[model samples]
Target: MSLIHCPECGNEVSTEAVACPNCGRPLAAPAPTIQRRVIVAEPRDDGFPKWVIAPIAILGIVVIFLLIAITRNNEDEANRTVNVNLATQRRTAEPRDAARDTSPPNRIDVPSSSTTVNPPAPPPSAPAPSYPSSTTTVPPSSAQTVPVDRASVVIDAKIATGAGAIQSVKNEKFYLLDKDLDAILADADLEPIEGNSLADSFGLAVLYPDRYGDFRRDALAAISKHIKYNATTGGDGRAAIKNVEPDSYYLFGITKAKNAFAVWSAPVSITAGENKLNLQPARLNEIAN
Candidate 1:
């Protein structure tokens, strides 16, 4: 314990005393002050971290797996469909392949050493070529080139309309018909209407319009065989036909004027490349009767 002298009594006293005891003066030292601080927590912007992440992650994985499985299933179905189609096509083609395989197998002869064989001599000269006449008929071929070696012809013909005498036979139809073909219309089959032979443009197209479609279709089918080729003239009396074979054919057509209808029937011989036949059917120009 430390001692300090009291000011009033000049007596000795302990430093811890609030007052001097010797002089009867009270002396208590002030107790030391202590301060405490309390910390306050603020609410967070995001919700509490109580949500389980593992379950959500597992659910997402399951959904992804299901989507993958569905995609694989769709792919499998498409592949199966394609495979089925390919199998069907193969089945369809097998018959065609079998039909085409009809030729007999090649014969391989083994000559014995004891036997002697001789090769036949080739012919001295080939036979002369026989060309198709007007009556000669050719079977239609699978390919176009063999039927007609791209032969073509263009014919422009006018009609005598009296005073003017020569007028363009407007909008006429021409057919290079294989007259020899059995499919061709015979002369007896041509019916006359209003003085116009069914062969005339007005008679065929205007009088019996319903038959025109069938006639046109039939004419085209005879390319190189029956109705070899056909064409339609514009305002001018001109028609271009590509049915030129190196054979003979019949140039047949129908044209018209104001009061007169004309039918053109003439035998034409087409040479190799290009051939044009001038039609002058003045006798048949008698007014459509």
Candidate 2:
């Protein structure tokens, strides 16, 4: 057993006592021993951990690829179906179009050869009828005297004023009538007649005697009728009555100078050919109102 002494009380006590029995003093606690343990941590990286992130990213990529493949396959299937339908439609329409293009434009019908036909014959021509013969005969005559074929009479006239100088008259028309000379002359009223009145009353051949009977009556009436002739002065102061039958004739005419009218009368004879007469001028007298 070991013994120890208390300083305050000077008591003996066991070595392991916390307080002494003789003196009430507190004991000091012993210092504990500190043992140091060295712990080492592994070096951590600054970014995300590769173990968890690598698996998630790989799974995402695989899902995206699967979706794209599915979409492409669907598009190719739709295109193939459309192409097949178009080809089928074109094949179905070709035969009908070729038939329409190759059709004929016209169709002709042929007759059968079982029936026979005959042609008609031509008509006959008739003969022409014969014509009768014609003959001409001549009669014998006793005397061989040649008859006069044609005759013409030219009657010229001028104004016989007391003066020696002759005057020219223009635009005078004369008449030739198959009338009774004695009857016309017996009526004193017919001596101073106008040209228009003579043509109207006696149906006389009126002519403008400007060019010396170049425009006179060519034909005369038969000799059985009494003949009367007229003379008129032309632009050259000469009047002519042409193409008269060969006979004795009485002539009558009237000329106008200013307000006075001159009445004239004479006798003329025509032969086989041309016969010219220079008649006497009549007196100028006033016309009765």
Please provide, for model 1 over 118-194, each residue's C-alpha lDDT reduced to its tens digit, 9 standing for 90 to 100: 11122355232222113222222212221224455666656655454656555666667768322244332432333
Give me candidate 1's TM-score against the actual structure.
0.35
- How far out, in Å, is residue 40 in model 2? 99
**Candidate 1 segments exceeding 4 Å error:** 1-149, 180-183, 187-225, 281-289
- Give all TM-scores, in the order shown: 0.35, 0.31
Per-residue CA lDDT of model 2 for 131-192, tens digit only, reads 22122212212122222333444444555444544554344544444443335533434421
Total clashes in model 1, counting residue pairs 3 or more apart in sequence or in different chains: 6
Lowest-sum lDDT 10-residue window in model 2:
111-120
Instruction: Write down the lDDT that model 2 would get.
Output: 0.44
Question: lDDT values of the candidates?
Answer: 0.52, 0.44
Candidate of highest lDDT: 1
